[model samples]
Target: MESFGIVKAKKNNKIFVEFTRESACGESCESCSAKCAESEKELFEFPNTLSADVGDVVKIKTRDRSILSYKFIVYGIPLILFMFTITLSYYLMSKMFMKNIELMSLIMGIISLFISYLIIKGIDHKFQKTNKGDIFLEKM
Candidate 1:
């Protein structure tokens, strides 16, 4: 994905860029009917490869491959984990002659989802601290 932002700050070899909704809106807003440009601003850090200064507009790029991995982490892993846990719990409960095996499996699945959520949140926190990611920036 490609986006445009204005450099918000500079520190060492890193530059923080701020992207507003209007700047990210690609096409002419007047002709569009979709409720596309929500009011928000996103800040991202990138290597200072372009030697951009504060208040300068820059172009940011993110590879499609990296995006796919992010999608899997945010959506796929929890779903897969839930399914696996539910199936495993159901089989185990059945073998143990437990009553309400379906209910037990559902409860186990929900528990697994909660665990996955914590894991994902930790990963997100670590990434936020490091500020090291796949974004590439250049002067516009």
Candidate 2:
């Protein structure tokens, strides 16, 4: 993905850029019917490949592949885990216990979902340490 922003600060090979939603909003405000609120500009630091100085307008690029993986991790995994756990727990509880199936399934599903959250948290911690989703400065 690509975005344009103004450089806000510079440190070594990294620069902070402030991006406004207007850059990505192509339609005229008056013509749009969607309820849109003006949002505050967001700032992000990216690896400075263009040697851009503070106040320079720069273009930033992030890999689409990286974004897909990130979205899957953030939304997909938890959903899959939750559904899988619910089904598996319900089936296992029905067969193994043969009594209080409903109560046991509900309990086990919740417990498994909590365990999935812990696993996701561990994955997030590892990714944070590696700076895995960093964007790159493409132009100035």
Candidate 3:
């Protein structure tokens, strides 16, 4: 994907870029009375390959991302982890003749979901170090 953003700051070897986040509706407010289809902002860090300065508008491009894989990792993994944890916990609890098996399984499932978040974070950090979806930037 390609986008334009303004450089917000620089720290270490990373340049912080501020982008106006877009919505699925494309911020079309003409037909809507609420006028709530406004844009929000997002901050992203990129390698300062172009030596872009703060306040500069830059064009950014990214590659090496598969949307399907990303979706599965971010959404599917947590769901699968939660379901697996619930099933396993329930089975173990039942085998042990423990009371409140359902409640315990549910608690375990929720905990596993949080753990999945940590796992995803770790994977993201590692991939970032490797620059999986390497971004290229140039001053606009």
* TM-score, cand. 1: 0.69
Q: What digit string (tens of lDDT, one per residue) describes model 2 on residues 1-105? A: 887899899998988889976533654476556635445599987777778889999877788887888789878877788778778878887778678787776
Q: Pick the lDDT winner.
A: 3
* All-Cα superposition RMSD per candidate: 4.4, 4.1, 2.9
Clashing pairs in model 3, backbone N/Cα/C closer than 3 A: none
Total clashes in model 2, counting residue pairs 3 or more apart in sequence or in different chains: 0
**Model 3, residue 131: what's the lDDT?**
59
Question: Candidates' lDDT values, in order?
Answer: 0.85, 0.78, 0.86
Count residue pairs with overlapping backbones in model 1: 0
Write down the worst ten-residue block by lDDT for model 2.
Answer: 22-31
Off by over 4 Å in 1: 21-37, 114-133
What tens digits encode model 1's per-residue C-alpha lDDT throughout 1-140?
88789999999999888997563465557666774754579898877888889999998778888788778888988999999999999999999999999999999999999999998899779866774567666698
